[model samples]
Target: MSSDDPPYLMALPDPVGAGKQKFQLCMSELLQLVRVHLPGRMAGAGPSEREQRIALRKALGYLDSDYLIDLPEPFFGALLRAAVYDPDPSFNRQFVEPLRVAFGARRTQEALLEVLRTGTNQERAGAARAWYWATLEMVEDIQVRWDQAALREFVVNEDIDVRRCLLPQLPLHPSHYPGELHPLVAEAVHIGRTHPDEYLRHRVELQVRTGI
Candidate 1:
């Protein structure tokens, strides 16, 4: 927010934790911060590492005195979703570790869909993209034991958004899904032509033409 932004934007009523005097923040505020700064702030980070630390400290001080947030399940879920996608690229294995900390940890499909349906637009998009990348990781781990159909059945989720996301990705490693290959390509073509998203349409069109 700008310097003139309202106080209520980061206001809080309750505090949490002992002796530490942590302040609580609304979930909406957290999402707002993520939406506001995020990687966008990385563009012009600082003049020096020390300057960056001071800037971060100043920003942190602006947080509500109730700095200890107790997130509801859905917000926690959103946090987990964000953690997986926004972290260091080398920590792909560590990314999945969020699943263990989430309430819907064991129910992968439900958890995935829940995040998609309820999280912020950017967040849902991230989780949807993460699913495709995560599926690729699983394929690498189990391709020797799992067949094409079995893998597809388990990985290709019920959500159209997710299915469409994964379809174009499949052909990238085409030698694996020998049996179900053609139909998926056809589906991708149909989606490209029919789906509302122009980007997905263009992507599918490219994949079909290039046979990727």
Candidate 2:
């Protein structure tokens, strides 16, 4: 895999296999929760719970063809959580895109930011992955806010996964931060540059070279 690619993209089996298993477990739990909280939602899947689980897994955990806009408030919230906490970043959009279509771009971004700020390391990493899709447009204020939050988290979060996920989204340039906070950006850049993950290192190198 190229340096810019996520570590999970490597041919190695352990990370990829483990991630897939985690994702499957998450989907199963989400399906059960949905059935309890939104009875009859899975009725079309068939009466047997095994059939319903299989159907939901095939459907990527979305119950119907409505893209989830028709789902009630609590279920939608649960879906958003599942999306941002999903271990496999590639599959997160299945849940995230529907929420974006239903909730609008700004709200989606705000929700992701909230997760980045407060979630566990895994969820924070997932939020960083989902942020790419959440930012459907260029809103300067929101972009700045997200950059700041991401940078702050990157500096303090020692989790390699979180750092790898956040690196691509951070504004590595010092100018993006206020004078007092410029050091924070510099520190983040240093961390990225020296990080053991080649993806993080290469991303920071490219950003520095391109001044992006």
- Kindly report which residue stretches of model 1 are placed more than 4 angstroms away from their true locations once superposed: 1-79, 84-125, 131-139, 142-168, 172-181
Q: For residue 206, what is the lDDT in candidate 1?
A: 60
lDDT value, residue 196 of candidate 2? 83
Q: Top model by lDDT, which number?
A: 2
Model 2: how far residue 70 lies from native, Å: 2.4
Positional deviation of residue 60's Cα in model 2 after best superposition, in angstroms: 8.8
Query: Would you list the C-alpha lDDT of every candidate in the order shown?
Result: 0.39, 0.69
Q: Report the poorest 10 consecutive residues by lDDT, candidate 1.
A: 15-24
For each candidate, what TM-score against the reference?
0.34, 0.72
Model 2: lowest-lDDT 10 consecutive positions: 9-18
